[model samples]
Target: MNKEDVSFEIFPPDFVLEPYHVFRKNALANRNRTESQEVDHDMDILYQFWSHFLVRNFNAQMYNEFRSLALDDDFSTRNASTGLHRLIQFYGASLSRNSVMPDQVVRDLVDLIRDEATTRAEHVAFYLLRSAWRSGSLDPRNREKIDSVLDAHMTAELEK
Candidate 1:
């Protein structure tokens, strides 16, 4: 992402932004050699990592900007695609009967994307929740909370 475009916005060090910046990379990378790829795979992973941290810190500007970027059709599917694949699989096992992703893990991840419910990028919270539900990994105690979150998201969308 270009620093000039986001010059109006707050930013961390260049090294930090290199992996997670998404605001102004050339929308058409192949079309423009001068432009950096719109979405960086490393950036996606970093974003997902930050998403976890954002759960506690909750920076509206940063979160909103990144999430808005994530909603785009070209936000790099690998953000949601490859990220946390090995991590989750290792921690929670596969989505099969022996799957071990904790209910709270599922719940928190769902909550992670509560504001941007429809995004398919970086951590793919919706998909994670679905996989847990299908695998019977989610505990009954947190089911209502997850449902409520999704229900509220749907309601907001319908109203919009």
Candidate 2:
């Protein structure tokens, strides 16, 4: 079969390629690049790429980074603290900011869980981070409160 026929066979019978239609109409669109008509197909493609990338990579990277930062004594003196604090503040100021607790809280919990799991010779960080990450979606307020409680507990422990 020809490439076009093969493609048609692969696609659902009712399927229509929207990008092909857009490409066909691009000459007309170029004549009228109005505010809404100005299509940034490149950005759309980039967004899709990153969306897939994050979906595929975020979990593994997040766990490893959290674990590494948690166990590393120098993390507090490094990017986990001040850099992350700035990120939280910037996101908090934006109206689009959905996060209620803070990234600092997340970083603190990562450190705390890492310490507990590593020093106690228990692989608790993965469990804690996984549960906390899940709770972030299910019960955000509870997640924040839990992090706060854990932070207090860790701080008190460190004070000794």
Candidate 3:
């Protein structure tokens, strides 16, 4: 599909982060209390938006901008990190349901898990594995690599 076929326009980072901020605020307010259905609904909308964006831009340059947001240290706070992880998850899940993910995206996610020592890394790794599994895109060798890294991460966490 060409750029013209895409129905949605890519928004600036600030615009993209607006829903995330709203969801984060709701989550923070709901902590230690019963979860609000409204928060869940908001998150669902956010995920849908992200999923659509990923699917439409899977082959476009906008993917690089999205990936940059996911890996950006400026957006690495706890809530932002969680939002990034969910965005990646939605993207991967969409690819799994429709088409194969690009090799570079897989490699970048694996590298993120390998180099980053954060919960976001683990979450991304898990979603990547799920996406690969569902899409039948992961070969045995790549599966082994991801498994090894996840195993090491789990072992470290257990030791701690």
Candidate 4:
């Protein structure tokens, strides 16, 4: 989670005008809204916005922040899972677009999914592994470890 670990220096002068800032603002507003008034429509839009933004921007700090928010137990499970799903999709797209995320960020994401052991987390881990394979960012040994975790998840699901 160190700021220095990720490259935020690639941002151009016009970054302030980017739609991500607008999404961020809306997402924050949604976070503070009362449960009775909150709507999934706004959350869905925010998730979509984040997915598109991350694919283009690929800032580790932003990614970490998004992941932390999504994984926070205080948030509704639906929102958290939706956020994580969008993030996993973003990671795949970003990798295919030739934008490399930091190693630590990837590792952290994988570890989080493994530790959480939810079906949604397993799906996220699968996407992460696919992205890693496509991007060639992970060493074979590490990849095997991730694959093993995914296999275990799948096995557990089948058993249930």
What are the C-alpha RMSDs, in order, of all predicted structures?
A: 12.7, 16.0, 10.8, 9.5
Q: On TM-score, who's better, 1 or 4? A: 4
- The residue-by-residue lDDT of candidate 3 on 82-146, one tens digit each, is 34555566545644554445666656655655554454435555545555655566566555444
lDDT minimum window of 10 residues, candidate 4: 71-80
Question: In model 2, what is the error at residue 139, expressed in angstroms?
Answer: 7.5
Model 3 alpha-carbon drift over 4 Å, by segment: 1-48, 77-79, 116-124, 127-160
Best by TM-score: 4
lDDT string, candidate 2, 3-55, tens digits = 55554776787865566336435523442342332323432332233323323
- Which consecutive 10 residues in model 1 have the weakest lDDT in total? 26-35
Candidate No. with top lDDT: 4
Compose the digit string of candidate 4's lDDT tens values, residues 1-160: 7756867778874544336577677767776663532335556566676678766766677776766665562234434466666666665665445444556655665665556565343455554555566657656655554445455654344234
What TM-score would each prediction reach against the true structure? 0.34, 0.21, 0.42, 0.53
Residue 135 shift from truth in candidate 2, angstroms: 6.8
- lDDT rank, highest first? 4, 3, 1, 2
**Regarding lDDT, does 1 or 2 come out ahead?**
1
- What digit string (tens of lDDT, one per residue) describes model 1 on residues 59-115? 556545544444332334323332233233322332333323345444544555563
Clashes of 4: 0
